[model samples]
Target: MKLQTALRLIYPPRCVSCGDLVESDFGLCGPCWRETPFIEGLACDTCGVPLPGHSDQIEHCDDCMRIARPWSRGRAVLTYKDNGRKLVLALKHSDRLDIIRPAGVWLARAARPILQDQMLIAPIPLHWSRLLKRRFNQSALLAQELGRLTALSVCPDLLVRPKRTESLEGKGHDARFTTLDRAINAHPKRKHRMAGRHVLLIDDVMTSGATMAAAAEACLSAGAHDVSALSLARVAKDA
Candidate 1:
């Protein structure tokens, strides 16, 4: 028997969410897949939130219209609820590295609409202290996987968080932005790679978009030609 087939038979592929046996790796079973809120149809051009009805022209959600998004465009793979939420949490906290493969695939699909030539993939930075606690940055993992799938260059440390900000959880929208403001900056040594290049920022989840805005601003200030964002999941208000 072939080595690949032997391995599969010995250790069957399992669902990423419910841990049930599945036909393929890094996938969800039927029930879990159905429960997952994969974003589809018409969505905001800036935030990737699903909007009512359809339009040929680009659309923006109320939040995206009201808030200042430093990135030129954005997309998300899933709505932050149900199985989507579970997948993000698993990757972020449970050390579920297996999810990266499926996430990269989904992110690649969502990113197709906004992809630019010679795009540089980078991840939202985590404070050094936080990085020490977590051992790894989930965003960095996602960015690396995305770069591999898309055949783009990945700069895992393109951005840095010199200062650690408190958690944005439970904080109001304005406060979240205020807390993250000026907190993210481009790495001085790596700024040369970002100059005059289009940058795509990756993150595990986007809530108020405060973190993405800060990272995008940092890239722009560092002389990036343009900035765009891709998140694994977006915390939609109605979701």
Candidate 2:
């Protein structure tokens, strides 16, 4: 307790969602924590998209029904706008290690019920140049936390982004999906490890579900029996 107090005195903690100083190191201030929607209620079971006035028994969303995902099922912690983008950007550029703990915990809480029986965790890897520039992979940080929570093995290098592509920054749906269609590949050595296993792919965000879908296809081609995604946030159309 004394050491913790001294540490706080030296460097007070801050909210993960906001930059306000916190009294403790638990990751977020009271109001900001409460404001973060944990994405509950009736969500799309297949892709984790929020549905309006959905019934619990409905097993799929219109998107999932019309177009099938290569993965088995997925979970997303937030609706991928507002504070969600802030959190992802904080970690991506600001070197916010503190956000990882709470974000991971929240992600674990969201994923636990669905992922209780999953076999392994695989974070989508960044391209070499981007990895060097960023000095970290946000997905890997989230994956490590999920691993710690669920006791699942984290394979940080199971999937790789073989080439750097144009950022999906201003791209429309068609362009974004097409960009990711060939962005991912499996590591040769890891291919054997994925056989017959249910792999959980982790990412900071899922926009258009294109990247995760491509990663899932790679996993399937590499011999994973089943694949699923768990993201911190997901982008959606204006409702």
TM-scores for every candidate against the unseen true structure = 0.98, 0.92
- Candidate 1 has a TM-score of 0.98
Error of 2 at 145 (Å): 1.1
lDDT of 1 at 164: 90
Residue-level lDDT tens digits of model 2 in 12-109 = 88776776898767577788777766688777777887777858485677778987689878878887777777777888899987788888888888
Give the range where candidate 1 is weakest over 10 consecutive residues by summed lDDT: 63-72
**lDDT per residue as tens, model 1, 20-139:** 999998899999989999999999999888889989999999998887788889999999998899999999999999999999999999999999779999999999999999999999
Q: Against the true structure, whose TM-score is highest?
A: 1
Question: Model 2 segments beyond 4 Å from truth?
Answer: 21-23
Computed on alpha carbons, the lDDT of every model, listed in order, comes to 0.94, 0.84
Q: In lDDT terms, how accurate is model 2?
A: 0.84
